[model samples]
Target: MNIRNEWVSFKIGDIYFPDPQQVAFERHKDDLLDGKVADLSDHGLLKEVFAVVEVEGIEQPVIVPVDRLSGPAPEMSAGEE
Candidate 1:
């Protein structure tokens, strides 16, 4: 699948994951934007989008949430903090 707009960066939350899982994501950083939307789930007001990406050392493509892929960075203000 082709995505019209590629993400500028990827930012995974500071969460724990198995060593293998972590490595998979890191290895596919460059191709993350090429991932395809394999599935989507409806959650009332929100819809969850999942992407299928191939990672090094992993035989099967991994599925991850679209939100994990960063878009335009949000602007912050000094007073907000």
Candidate 2:
């Protein structure tokens, strides 16, 4: 889902997951502007979540919920961080 012109995505998985935040950002092949996650307790299932991936130009982020997301996101650049 998209919100405030940006996009957000959420993920849920094993109890020993690395950083969920990092994996969420990796899912996107394109650059993200700015975004974050939101709570969705209405479902009563905590396994679900929301994400906010910032979209360029639109000045907003998109949101999506998924299960079993990958591990730490791949390095964005080769240069020193």
lDDT of 2: 0.45
Per-residue lDDT tens digits of candidate 2, residues 1-81? 447877755444432476665665676556533332333334525557544434345554555553433322345223524
Q: If scored against the real structure, what TM-score would every candidate get?
A: 0.30, 0.28
- Predicted candidate 1: what Cα RMSD to the true structure? 17.6
On a 0 to 100 scale, what is the lDDT of residue 29 in model 1?
57
Worst 10 residues of 2 by lDDT: 32-41
Candidate 1: residue 44 lDDT (0-100): 21
Measured by TM-score, the strongest candidate is: 1
